[model samples]
Target: MARNNWIAVASAQHARRGCAIPERGYMQVCHGKRAPLQRVAPGDRVAYYAPTVTMGGKDTLQKFVSIGLVKEGSPYPFDMGGGFVPFRRDVAYVPAQETPIAPLLDMFDFVEDRSRWGYKFRLGLFKVSDADMRRIAQAMQVDLALLQFESLLF
Candidate 1:
């Protein structure tokens, strides 16, 4: 389907903010580092996994909060005032529910240790296999056909 499938870690508050942008959604990983985003090409599928409701907070919210396809553009810098310029890529977000990761951990090919599922997410953003992406889509209740409509193969 997508050129690549990726999992991005962010707080639910921050993830929701990116998906809430008018017209098109956006994604910023590793605190706006452009280098990581550079590896993600247009048409790739990305899902945001939120471990908490807010950044650096203990309120656990282990859910895949956003799912989308990367738009046709390179990472661009955006100013958030106070000289905070974060590089982000445009994403076309689909309608999906925030899904918990507990049920899908066993199906993850990336996670070798079931007891350390959260360890993989520490990378902030990382590429995943197609199987992993499909599993995530199913968990999120997002239609693969809907994603395929955007030129992604199954």
Candidate 2:
């Protein structure tokens, strides 16, 4: 099988504080002294933070499905599946119906649909380098922000 880069998103703040691991949680942040380099190598593992409906965002999984990035009936690879990991609702989803129900389909619909449908995810065509991510951040000139998660591929 081909190796895939896996991005792990967690709620822990350890990554921002420069800690190797969070004090508690099923997963740890990917930051700090031993922070995995920017790019996920073919066989490395890492984690980061991501938004979820539970965390105050729309249904992220639906976005994956609309983009044809994920398929149904597949086991979610990351822990805390169908929860925790939230993506931007407007940018990341497809409606189950030809047109989503009004009011219900509003941005908040993402929040309501929590656990309503099975979600699958796959990375898009953005295989960028750590240096690239860094350079972009640098060129745009923002805080030395770490991506919200870590990823491993083997």
What local lDDT score does residue 83 receive in model 1, on the 0 to 100 scale?
A: 94
Residue range 5-104, candidate 1, lDDT tens digits: 9999999999999999636799999999999999999989999999999999999999999999889999999999999999999999988989899988
* Global Cα lDDT for candidate 1: 0.90
Query: Which run of 10 residues does model 1 get worst, by summed lDDT?
Result: 145-154
Highest TM-score against the true fold, candidate: 1
Where is model 2 poorest over a 10-residue stretch in terms of lDDT? 63-72
Best by lDDT: 1
